[model samples]
Target: MSISKKTWLLIIAFFCVYVFWGSTFLWNKMAVKELPPFFLASIRFTSAGLLVFAISIATRKSLAITRKQLLNCTLAGFLFLAYGNGVFVWALKWVDTGFASLLASLQPLIILLMMRVIQRKKLQWKSMVGVTLGIIGMYLLVSQKDIISKEGMVIGILMILSCLIAWCSGSLFVAKADLPKNFFVATAYQMIAAGVILVIASLCFQEPWKSPLVWQDNTQIAIICLILFGSIAAFTSFNYLLKHVSPEKVTTSSFVNPVIAILLGWYFLEESISLQTGIAALLLLTGVYFINSRKRDKPVVVAKTKV
Candidate 1:
């Protein structure tokens, strides 16, 4: 692809991840209101995984993999979706969607540190400064929000941070791991493995079989949106970006995702954004600018650690 075409594709993918994943926070918040977190997450992951897996097979991609590949996908699935996302869904029980995403903005920072430690990569001063500003922006964003309960807020923050660590670790692993060459095939395995595990956890904890279905129109819509946009569209775009760009740059969408989530919350749920939100928005956006527009040429080449 020409540089210009690649740039436009990256831009489009970034926007998809930013908007759709941001909206997933709301989808999650709505679904959690009516169903158990693990149960809802299990359904979403399974459906999305199966859908993608079938697509891959129909498109003539190999579903067959070596044991090592399966192990890699399983480990990544556990970390990325099961622990990272499943626990995140559980955290949504106590945290608001916007607030959860604000906490998630910490991923870029976690990724920065983890890559430096695990991969022995050196960070640029400019990138470090951008990460610091993003952290400060998150603090400001959370500080101005309406406190739900001090106890619940603290619990939710801790839970989200735990998943943030797992997510960052999983992302770094994916950057280096030898999985299938086809991106969709790799993602399909991850989702399928994670989905199966989550379903088991749901049965153990939620026991949905013991209860009647509590499906509602709004909840169903949210779930469908999550499966289609959040899981299929945004996640595929995310993995695509991962293949072509730096993880740091791929995750720049985290900054934008929170901004979108806050706005959606305000529009749909009437969640208020204070003046701090506006100021924080500027800081966050500027931080992403610095991260994405770093002086490095060919950041993807430097940032990637091939296995």
Candidate 2:
């Protein structure tokens, strides 16, 4: 039997989240090389948010939202994008792109733990094993002598971990929070709210902003890709998938992202993958698999957004 149109759309959406979202690490790394993290993130989100709005209008979707929804959107934006993403990108200043993606692969583990705490749910056998492996993998990844010896490495790792917490918190919020009926409009609201806050934060931090015209060509191109593909297309696809598929299935991106990121970093940036990193990746990704693959008493539907 031939696939339906909906099937095709789902396939396309999955491809966007898998490939485009994974490539965001490289794009963010390139942009952050010359621009302050807040500045880069602010511009990227604001521009992408506006573009999303434009798309909404072109498609004749209503933009109206309740006051409560707007507030929820703002909070989600700050948690997911402003602090979660901005600081993560900042950490990239001191961390390798591939290494950072591998760190991000731990998000599933973090989210599972968050569920245990917030929902007061007991961990299953698989979840417990997964958490144990995740801890061991994290230690192995960060405790590497060559990685830890680098200046600012410890700080970078800490910041990324903090960002993971923020992101996991946002994921939990978005699952049950009231927001716009239209996912695109909701995303636009979140992106714009995040962009505005990032702008203020960038100012407060005394980050000198320069005209985009003066930015290096590669940085400019990377920013464009971030706006068009990373923030807009891939994120929309992610939201779409969460609605159409089980959250567990959508979360397979966690596994795919790091592998794609590592390969891209190696091919494009010549980043090395140490034997230690490979072992750590095996353990971490295996833990993620176990956590995601565990049998459930009921269907667990968790909504997760991207980097």
lDDT per residue as tens, model 1, 276-307:
86777677666756665666543532211000
Candidate closest to the true structure, highest TM-score = 2
TM-score of each: 0.84, 0.95
- How large is the C-alpha RMSD of every model relative to the true structure? 4.5, 1.7
Candidate No. with top lDDT: 2
- Candidate 2 C-alpha lDDT tens digits along 1-307: 9999999999999999899989999999988989999999999999999999999999999999999999999999999899999999999999998899989888878888888988987998999999999999998899999989999999999999999899888978887899999888998999999999999999999999999899999999999999999988888788788879887888788789899889988998888999999999999999988888888776554343455
- State the C-alpha lDDT per candidate: 0.76, 0.89
Clash counts for all predictions:
0, 0
